[model samples]
Target: MPFDFPLIATIAAVFLLAGFVKGVIGLGLPTISVGLLSLVMAPAQAAALLIVPSVITNLQQMRPTATLLPLARRLWSMMLGVILGTLAAGGLIAGANAAGAAAALGAALVLYAAIGLIQVRFQVAPRHEAWAAPVVGGLTGMVTAATGVFVLPAVPYLQAIGLEKDALVQALGLSFLVSTLALALTLSGAGVFTWASVLTLVPALAGQVVGQWLRTRIDAVTFRRWFFAGLLALGAFLALRWLLA
Candidate 1:
């Protein structure tokens, strides 16, 4: 499809804003970008637009957390499970169930954030870690492909694990990288990776990389507060949309 000037401009602007937010907070680029893009494009096109930018930002984030291998290793099972779940969901992710699932996911995020504020934490012993990681990973994978609900659950768990802020951010970037590759592969196999979509990655990644670079100058506390606030607002919006329907 040839690009529409107004639509491309809007997508670029929205992505720039999303990139800035993600750069500051280390996440939210995809959720924000996807949500915003849906207003202008089909859902699949929106997702396709996000793939390169998300991957680029994750690669950028991954560089700093290179030494967090131990933590990453520990979380491998869950990550793998997420990949499997995404693969399993396939095109089913585009159905009516997706909207309902997305709304539920939004509600879950609000609840999780609320519980975190209340200091009601899940105890993650070694045994629990073993079980929780894979289960969470699968859920994350399914949600990522479906509507990005996967990150909401995993983010809280990452915080609960006492992973350093940098470590958590890196893990998130890695998670996105892995899951996106899986999605791309699936799309490729299904004959949906058109040349135009592949070409769009260049500009998308350029914007995302710029955002990642801008992140280092932000204050940590301020970044996190804004990050969670954005997530909360997004969750509420999603829930309301569902309720109205």
Candidate 2:
């Protein structure tokens, strides 16, 4: 179905909001955007619309962080796992029904929010993490491509390793960028990208800028508390809507 004008405006507004939240919290752009957009569009279309903008916007988010080559080298194995996982789960995403897909995604967000509430911190040895990396990365990659879900069983492992904030942000950004690029290329081969998808970028970019600006003024802890709460709220709202519908 073609997008009506009102739908376009609503998506633009949601992206702008999602971006602001990401800027403040170091993540959430995709989660928030995907959650909100699925309300108005097919899950496949929502995922496609985000592919170009997420790559561009995440690059901007990653620009502020300094290089941590040593750390990056350590994480390469995890990245590899993410790639394999994406390839494994990528096909299932496009086939999911919109409401069912959204509900699944919403449940994941709720789980992430609950984990965030625990404020858990840990210290794991590299060897242990090395073993764990593939499992987490692969799951992260698959959900990211399909439903924009990037929480527990994926991101938490990165956080647990005591990765520095800047490096962590870049790592997350790079993961999404790589996976999305792969997804985009695959979809393009399958004739998925189109003018309407291209049209969604303008508002998405606008939101990214706004989100970055919001990032600076907020205290990190406060920002995270509210951010996760929003995720929980978004998930709850979606669940209720689905039940009602």
Most lDDT-accurate candidate: 2
Q: List the residue pairs that clash in candidate 2.
A: 16-207, 19-211, 20-211
Q: Write the per-residue lDDT of candidate 2 for residues 4-119, one digit (tens) a residue.
A: 77887787787777766766666776787778787777666667777767777767755653484665677777778777776676655566466766777778788888788777
- Find the candidate with the highest TM-score and give its number: 2
1-245: candidate 1 lDDT, tens digit per residue: 67588887787787777777776667766666766665455445566666776777778778754566876788899779878988887554355464664565466556654654455665566757888888887877776666643465676666666666777777887777887776665555555444454445555566666766766766766666665666667667767877898
Worst 10 residues of 1 by lDDT: 191-200
Alpha-carbon TM-score of each model against the true structure: 0.79, 0.86
Q: Look at candidate 1 and tell me the lDDT of residue 151.
A: 64
CA-only RMSD, every prediction: 3.4, 2.6
lDDT of 1 at 36: 61
| Model 1 misplacement above 4 A | 64-68, 96-123, 189-191, 194-227, 242-245
